[model samples]
Target chain A: MKVKAYITLKEGVLDPQGKAVEHALLSLGFQGVSGVRVGKYITFDIQVRSEAQARDQVEKMCQKLLANTTIESYQFEIIQS
Target chain B: MKFGVVIFPGSNCDRDCVHVAQTVSGNKVESLWHKETSLPRLDCLIIPGGFSYGDYLRPGAIAHFSPIMPEVKAFAERGGLVLGICNGFQILVETGLLPGALMRNVSLKFICDRVTLEIENNKLPFTCRYPAHSLVSMPIAHMEGNYFADSETLKRIEDNNQVVFRYHGDNPNGSLHSIAGVCNEKGNVLGMMPHPERVAETLLGGQDGRLLFESII
Candidate 1:
């Protein structure tokens, strides 16, 4: 099973890197582009028998280590490939 | 007081802390490797500054899962005094042993320089040598040293008098209200981004940093 986790800073939290990227984009002539919040994409393989089990395990990993719950939120997808 | 300094794979300031503890304060200090599962008896534990685990993912985010962190958490929960300096502070917050997270410097750059710090409260074992509201200069070297917490947690920490140090004159990192350091609710643990151990001797240009270690002693 392939699991992917997308981690992002929560709302109302300042994202300096994302802001910097947004500025660079504006400088490059991209217009009307806003809310450029940058996030992380992590992919890993799990040996779970079922997709549900893989999702459960990856969710646990995200909550425990992949993402900091205090300032970041995470969502994941389990792909049976 | 006897001290132990945790050494992660990428920790670069562990010796600086050991020097302050062993030579400056004349206390026994030991280096506890991250893979170790047990710690000897210690009065104080220091997580020194440096780019632990190369600051990957985020400062202290990866290092907190080291093999020794569980033991460190247990020790802190037992009320043992824990002092996290710089990268160490990041680890402490990541471990949930301290309130708030350290955000990137508002300038989005790695800042390294000497800056004045206001002693918000001197009642702590770490700051008892300085009079309250007094000022001291210390070196700060970090890209992510801005202290941030939700407004509610900020209010609680402020109401509980957990804030121990604030930036004086220059807010180098745009930390929340210029916060440089804070302690746990019980005041047994402290995490700060500045490197006090770096300026502990006159040879380093100032002895202000020595007082903090002496106070702990």
Candidate 2:
């Protein structure tokens, strides 16, 4: 199975990189853009027999390594390889 | 006082820390590798700054799980003095040795310059040499130096007087409450974003940072 994870800053956490991108877009005449936030997308192969097992393993990985928890939150999808 | 400086693969300031430790304490300093399973006798442990593990995923995220980290945790649990600077501060937070996380600077750029820091709680073992609210200039060089924590955690840290230093004048990295350095509840472990090792000698333009090392000695 292959698992994909999306890691992002928490709701109240400031995203300076995202803010800079937003400003650049505005300067380029891209309008109606707001609340632009940046995040990371990662994919990795996992050897698991079931979707439940993959989810469980991915959750632990996210908690331990993929996300800082204090500032970032993460979610993942388990896809058949 | 004996000192130990942990050298991660990408740690660039380990030598500077060792030099400062030896200069201030006039004692032998040991360099502990990230793969080492044991630590020699030491009174203070310094985690110097650099892009450990190339700051992959996040600063200090990957480096915190090195083989030597368990021993580092054990040493801190035994009430050993541990000081984390810059990238080291990021590692300490990742290891849960300290609170909060270091995020990207609000400027969205790497900042490397001297900024004034006010000694928030000089009573800490890390800052005992400085007087209350004294302002000292030190160089801060990092991209992910902004500190963040939930309101409840911030309140508890503030109430416990765990904040050891604060940025004076302008808020450089948008850290909450302008915090530049903080200590654990027990006040034995300290994590700060400034590079005290860089400014520890007069020949380097200032000796303000030497006071921190002197305090530990």
i-RMSD per candidate, Å: 1.1, 0.6
Question: Model 1, B58: alpha-carbon shift in Å?
Answer: 1.7
Q: Write the per-residue lDDT of candidate 2 for residues B30-90, one digit (tens) a residue.
A: 9999999999888899999999999999999999999999999999999999999999999
Best by TM-score: 2
Candidate 1 deviant stretches above 4 angstroms: none
Q: Model 1, range B1-217, lDDT digits (tens) per residue?
A: 7999999989999998998899855867999999999999998999998888899988899999999999999999999999999999999999999999998898989998999999997998999999889999999999999999999999999999899999999899989989999999999999998889988889888888898899999
Q: DockQ for each of the predicted structures, in order?
A: 0.66, 0.94
Q: How displaced is residue B125 in candidate 1, in Å?
A: 0.8
Candidate 2 clashing pairs?
A: none
Candidate 2's C-alpha runs over 4 A off are none
Worst 10 residues of 2 chain B by lDDT: B37-46
DockQ of candidate 1, scored on C-alphas against the true complex (2 decimals): 0.66
